[model samples]
Target: MSEQKFTVGSSITESYRFLADHMPHFFRLIYGPLILWVMVMVGEQILLIEHDIHINSVYFLNVITAAFAIVWYRQFLLGSDYASYRLLIKKGFSNSPLSFKRVSRALLRILVVSLVLLVPTLLLSFSMMVYFHGQGVPLSEAFIQELAFKSTLIIMLVFSPILIRLSLYAAGFALGRTSLRMQDIWKRTRGYTVTLWWVTLRAFLPLSIYSYILTLFLDVMSEKLSINYIVSTIIIETLAGFLTFMILAIVVAANAEAFRILIGVRDGDVPHRDGLKKNTAMPPQTNRRQTSKDIPQKTR
Candidate 1:
């Protein structure tokens, strides 16, 4: 078994190089669907502004992100050799290689992992929201809601590293590399929890710093220019959208890279030699501790 240590710096660097090498095609792959998604987002923002509410509605945007992420993950894992419009998400939904069932299964697994970690925080946040809204102060309603939303985001950011431990399932499901069961994920990723956390921190640290600085700069610009408040705010809200998309794309690739490395080891409770297949028979088992057959063997 290749019990090699996870290299955080190398993972980030390799993912960056990979994206740099393939960015044009990558953008084409995501452009159409992403544009429509942005349109809807802008429409929602306009509606919110009309209602005198300032907070951005992000739940739908998150779903759109996840949809594109599946495409990116599968592309990286399956390689471009597979002849499918897997890149064209709009076409891919029905006409591409991924079956409706396969996508649904992946979505279900993602939801399960997300809800497990999110439920407790959500419950507490919900209680706080209910308590505040019941106070019935009209002006305070939007303020309280936005406060709760930001608080939830902060809590999520704090727990982000912990979320990375279960990332194998995220990248894995995109290619059906592992079973959907949480126990399977836990056993598959055991002993490497701390390593995954480090990867998350390194991957996101730059984005966090960049975000803070960009907000400061933009706020200064908004004040100095004396632009329309809604326009400036919308521009600010979506200013880092592309950078964020790129960073998250790199993170998804990094997760896939980590999965390819760690999934090979014949670790605790990972009974099979090759990875778990989506609908086919399991690969023949092995007792040699490790064999390089499931994923494309790479030269290090």
Candidate 2:
């Protein structure tokens, strides 16, 4: 069957329709890890206690999280049957058991990406230690510097999941299904990503403003000797983040996928319909008529 073509710059409603129409199996491409991460975060927070060992807890958590990511990645890739979009969507998004082999492969990619992101921080820490040792800094001072260095590592570990997920989505869109080169895909998508980022930031502006207002209210309540004001503020932040993510997910994903479709059409991967085709020149046979010239002459 010929592919259906769509024009760019269509309405927001149309964008929604397109996503609804093409509901690929890999739709969980963005949300699976997200749900896992939230659960992990909640569990970790709940388990924090004075009696328990907190030493290197964040580091261990990072390792475990990286493992989870890798496992999922492998499953996603394996289900794609070596990166075919159709197959990937079909198997990866199913309710059946995730392939153990895919999980292994995903873990490897996660480890590689994680290491690439971590190396710089690791080097900085080593350099700091060597420099401080050379200066004969006291043990306590040296320990404090090391703690700060490790804290930086922890921060990177926290944000690494977000970066990895975005990169995977971009890379998948670029290379996985359509067979485009990474560089070419990046060129097509870089601008879209920038635009999405700007729109996303704008979308969060309201939340930020509301957060400030809520903070002020909390402060007032605190001054007035109200209890659990912080709890209310925390709830607001949680709800705001969830709502912001949900709203932006729809807008950004729709627009991004729309652009992808446009790219595909431009490459002749999707064909325009007869009425919608643009070129004006007609074929010689287009206006041909049934003629009776020879028969009429004979009759005459």
Candidate 3:
């Protein structure tokens, strides 16, 4: 494995490497379906706004996104490896080739897990909404019932993808290289989750700062003689989006590396080879041990 460690995980260079090394076709894997969903949603919204039309297409579209999320999550988990990371970076700059089977598996898992997680959250949201409405209006009313149901369902839909990601991380710890059961994965990851969150917060802070500054600048600039504010806003938005995407990729890559390290431990690769028993794939740790010993001991 490369000794180079990514502190932010999805820094621009690491993100580039992640895609180039692991799955070159990752863009197509994500954006193809995403674009379709966006187009459908945008078109529906446009029609409603432009022509006083009402279409129930939003429900179907949400369903599709949830379905796609399920399939992608499972496949990614099953097929993930260090090789995937390496290949993502070394391959073509313009094209990334990822496996379809892997993609399909990931997507399928996402859908299943999303549903599992969404149910409880949805129920809670619905119950709260209904309780609030009933305090002021009749619970038996048709509109109240309908509002409660629809709001609950949409809340579930919004949460589905987040749930799927959680499930995949859980599943990966259970069956991926680490081979730890779900409970163990949970215990281990729970220890690391705070650290990961901190890192993510740091990664996002830069963008947030940039956005705030840009917005402030825009507010001031807008006050000046007429500016092509729309173009500047678009450019800023694009830059922000790209930066965010790169950061996300880095984060994903770092998690993948962390998982690999945990998997190594699970495979009986001890901190030092001497601590290990019998023949194994793990390399000897003579130099590592020597290096450890040369360090001045702290007076405890």
Whose TM-score is greatest here?
1
lDDT-sorted candidate list, best first:
1, 3, 2
Task: Summarize candidate 2's per-residue lDDT along 1-300 as a digit string, tens digits.
Answer: 114343333424443443343234224433443454445444444455434534433564454333333332332223222323334444543323458875675567568766866776667666767777789975586696665678576756565434423543543432334344445545544445444444434434555576667656755765577545345444443544344333433344333434344344333222211212322244435423212111111111
lDDT of 1 by residue, 212-279 (tens): 79877997999899987667766765655555667677887777677767665223212221233321
Between candidates 1 and 3, the TM-score winner: 1
- Candidate 2 C-alpha error for residue 290, in Å: 44
* Model 1: per-residue Cα lDDT at residue 249: 74
Please name the candidate that would achieve the greatest lDDT relative to the true structure: 1
Better of 2 and 3 by lDDT: 3
- Each model's lDDT comes to 0.62, 0.43, 0.46
What ranking emerges by TM-score with the best candidate at the front? 1, 3, 2
Name every residue pair that clashes in candidate 2: 70-106, 70-107, 74-102, 74-106, 75-102, 80-88
TM-score of 3: 0.43
RMSD of each: 9.9, 14.3, 12.1
